[model samples]
Target: MNPLISNALKKDLELYFSEDDLSRNLYYTASLPHDLVDCKLKLKDDLLLAGLPYFVEAFRYLGDTSLDWDYFKKFEGKTYKKDEKAEIHFQLPFAIALTGERIALNLLQHASSIATYTSKFAARAKDKGIAILDTRKTTPGHRSLEKYAVRVGGGYNHRLGQTDLWMIKDNHKSFFGGVKEAVEFFRSMKGFYTPIEVEVHNMSELEEVLSLGIRHIMLDNFSPEEVKRAVKLKPVGVSFEVSGGIRLSNLDDYLIKGLDAISVGALTNGAPNVDISLKYNR
Candidate 1:
């Protein structure tokens, strides 16, 4: 498992199984007649696949140590159909399987859904060199996994967190009096390595930020005409990203030239859970 994934799952194990269940599950498994069991996972709907990392970790944490991580990883990043056996003929102790079932399914469905949705938008921008970006509006405690799924679906990540990229958003502008002040304050700070990307709503603010040598600007909620105007006025080498209300449905309308990226919060926030289920063979 990736170290980051391993660390995130550390909390998951504790969250999914209570201390009593954690202690008792071992005892429960010990009492079972069968030492090993067979299980398979079947998806009820077609979806782009993701989240095999969590599944392997779940089994590993629950006492199945013989898993070949590389071999099992083949199922991830691949699409599957309804009624497809995603995990076929895998054996683990029955108690362990029972304990990890829901967590594994949750991870798989949640990630695959985001991946599936991301692909929809990514495909819209395939030839344009436009990168599909996910916003910070991810579920708590699963940002890395969610972001990873976005990449799996052929989209790119914006930033891991606030620490990596300095974004002067609306609230920051409000707190610091205005966009100019916010940008000035960020520029005045020393040792900031990453370039600042400020949110601009109109032509004047976009022009001002451009003058400030801000290389990346997010055109929040701009219509296609406004986006075209901004692109025409934008400096060469500076990238413009669009956000707010941008979905796969309305995406083509905004694919103006010189538009570099689009950050969709719905990639993680509004994504539907893809249908995937696990059943142990009787």
Candidate 2:
């Protein structure tokens, strides 16, 4: 495990354990009926599968036992016919009815939903010279997990957070006079080690940042036409990203306008839980 994840998962596990310790096997010790063998997960509709590892991990964590995990997909990095089955094959190691089934599915369904949405968007952007990007508008404390699902769905991540990269947004724009002043202030701090990206809301600000030699520019809330114009006016080798209020309905329009990347907050914020069920398969 990455040190970051090692530290974080340990903390999360401790929290979960503490919260349920009062029950003292009230949930886990319930005797399950005979002949019930395995729980198999099935998708209600075709979906781009993701977060399989996390689903298994959550089950193992809750049950404090292991079960076989079986995965089946018709294709890799592609869509599937409707009504396909995605299963998690496993049997309880003991005849104990698990109490955390709902919680386990909650994580699986939500995470898979983000991945499915991301995969759909990424598929549309594919071969169009545009890359699908996810923003920081993720569930607090689940940023790493959500972003990991984005990658599994074929999308790229923008800066993980402020600590990972430098972004001069409108708030920063206010502290300094404008883009030029902000860029200058950061440049003057010569020892800093991060790429600086400035947000430009309109053409004038775009030109101002370009002339100041900022390597990256973000076009917030720009229409497709405006995005194209920004791309045309940007200096050679300057990277541009588009963000704000993007959705599946209008994503292609922006891609068609030739953007280098587009960040959709809805990937994590507005995700709809994918439908999955676990039932006895045998």
Candidate 3:
């Protein structure tokens, strides 16, 4: 289990239950045998599944959540029929059955939904070197987990956080007086090793970054034609990324424009939960 996830889940559970006395009441009634037990998960729609570990991890840590996963019953990046059942065997005290079930399914459905949406966009933009990138615009505490699903569904990730890489956006440029000064400041930092990405809205700024020889650039809010032109004008060896208002519907315009990658906020923010359910198989 990733330490980040372990820490986040611990924090989340602690935060949610700080004032609640329900944990004791809920645990007693939901406990199951700490020996082998059978449970199954079902989905109501076809989806690209991801984040199985987080689902399992959440349960394992949640007093009743860990179970012996039945590998043969799993979906391996394949589509599933609606109402299909997937099984796992685990031992838990019956006292916390409901608690474990709810947490596991919630994580599974939410993560899978993001993966489903990402897969759809990635498939549509296959080829043209146009990788689908998930932005840091993710659920605040669930960044790593959500980004993991994006990767599982054939998409790539942008910077993980402010510390992961240097992403100088328009606001930073304005706050620091101008783009040139920001570029020079970053360039001057001793022992700096991270790749720098600057966001530009127009051709003039793009030209300015080109002079700075920054290798990664974001073309924010550019029209399809402008993106194409920017792609042409990009300094040789520099990669171009597109963001702001990108959607599955208008993807083809940018896809055909031959941008290196497109980052969509919807991959995490507005993704609808893929319908899933739990059914007891007798």
Q: Rate the local accuracy (lDDT) of all candidates.
A: 0.83, 0.71, 0.74
Tens-place lDDT digits, model 3, residues 1-282: 455656766765554334344556756544544443445566678787776766666566656434544552266356665656544344444434445566667667878888888988999888667999999888876786688888878899887877666788888899889998887777666527788889999999999988988899999999998998888886668889999898988998888554788999899997877877754422
The sequence of per-residue lDDT tens digits that candidate 2 reaches over residues 1-282 is 123533455555445446546367655455544344677666676666665555555555654444434332222234443555555466653343244455556666776788888988888988887888898998876786788878878899986887566788998889897777887777776736778888889999998888888888899999888887788886778888999888988887888544688888999888777787767533
- Across residues 25-134, which tens digit of lDDT does each residue of candidate 1 receive? 56665775545777877767778888888777877776677666767687788877776545545777776787778877787788899998898889889888889999
Better-scoring candidate (lDDT), 2 or 3: 3
1 or 2, which is superior by lDDT?
1
Give every collision pair in model 2.
Answer: none
Q: What's the candidate order when arranged by decreasing lDDT? A: 1, 3, 2
Could you tell me the lDDT of residue 173 within candidate 1?
89
- Overall local distance difference test of candidate 3: 0.74
Sum up the clashes in candidate 3.
15
| Leading candidate by lDDT | 1
The true-versus-predicted C-alpha distance at residue 148 of model 2, in Å, is: 1.2
TM-score for each predicted model, relative to the true structure: 0.91, 0.83, 0.85
